[model samples]
Target: MGALMSVAPEPGWPEPEWHRPPVGGYTADDLDRLPNLPPHTELIDGSLILVSPQTAFHMRAMRLLENRLLEAAPPELDVAREMTVTLGPRDRPEPDVLVVKGEAEPRQTTFQPEDVILAIEVVSAESEARDRNVKPRKYAEAGIRHFWRVEEDKGLPVVYVFELEPATKTYVVSGIYHEQLKVPVPFPIKIDLTAINRRQP
Candidate 1:
């Protein structure tokens, strides 16, 4: 007897069939099984939302911010980029940058809300509403203590910092920084946004 083999699709040809989620929607487990998902595909209330691709400016800002945070973070805390934070059974958001407690363990897939100390999102044209409004509410409700949003204005980075109100499960603006990002929570650190936003050669 010979072994059966599946035929591969020809170059430049689409697959004969594609897997689609059920009418109800895809669960977190279902999303986890799919491979080759576009970067920043998130599951929110069982609906998959594709976050827009990061612009070159966004990438540079994120890298610069991450490096600064990593430098100031205490040994008990760690910084990560584009890691999934599980908010609920159907909510898995990949924040642009995040600060978490302790070092990363091997094979860690997603972070629980409690495991995260701060979550940062850089607003993009496509995700402004979600980043500025929707995510803050959700992150607050999940009991994550701190949040920061970076907005690009006139080609410069503007940082907004927030802290959670435990009673209301909401975030209140702590500070807004234009050329500098300075904060006391999660350890005191300062970042020169102007320098970070400068074009790299």
Candidate 2:
């Protein structure tokens, strides 16, 4: 017996059966187990959400943030890009960038919400609503401490920072940055937004 995903699909090519959802859709645990799923596929409310092709801005910005975060992160924490955090039995959403407590294992694919300290989403035209509205709310509800939403402004990056309000299970805006992002929680950090100008990371 062999797994459906035993052999990797070529770039831009997914398994033909990838579009077919399970009888009840997919659950959080099914993401790694399902062979037909393309990389970066996410399960939201038990439905698989296929990722749209990446734009240059989206690609560059995400990588820049990931690199800057890895550099600024404390020794005890880890930073990963495009990794899913398991929020519940039926919910698993992949953030553009995430910071988690403790060291990363060799094959870990998901992080529990409690282990994620920060979840960052860079807004894309197709996912603006979910990035700005849905995902942050869910991250907060799961008790993740911090969230950041990055949006484009005149072709530059603008970052919005939020802190979880434990009492209400919601996020409250802590600050917004247009050029540089300097934050104290998660870790003391400073990022130069202009670095995304090169258009690739």
TM-score of each: 0.87, 0.88
Alpha-carbon lDDT, every model: 0.80, 0.84
lDDT of 2 by residue, 65-107 (tens): 9888888998889998888999998889999999999977989
Off by over 4 Å in 1: 1-19, 198-201
The residue pairs in collision within model 1 are none
Top-scoring candidate (lDDT): 2
Worst 10 residues of 2 by lDDT: 1-10
Q: CA lDDT of 30 in candidate 1? A: 52
| lDDT (Cα, tens digit) per residue for candidate 1, span 75-157 | 99999998888898777877889999887788876898989999998888877777888888889999999999999888888
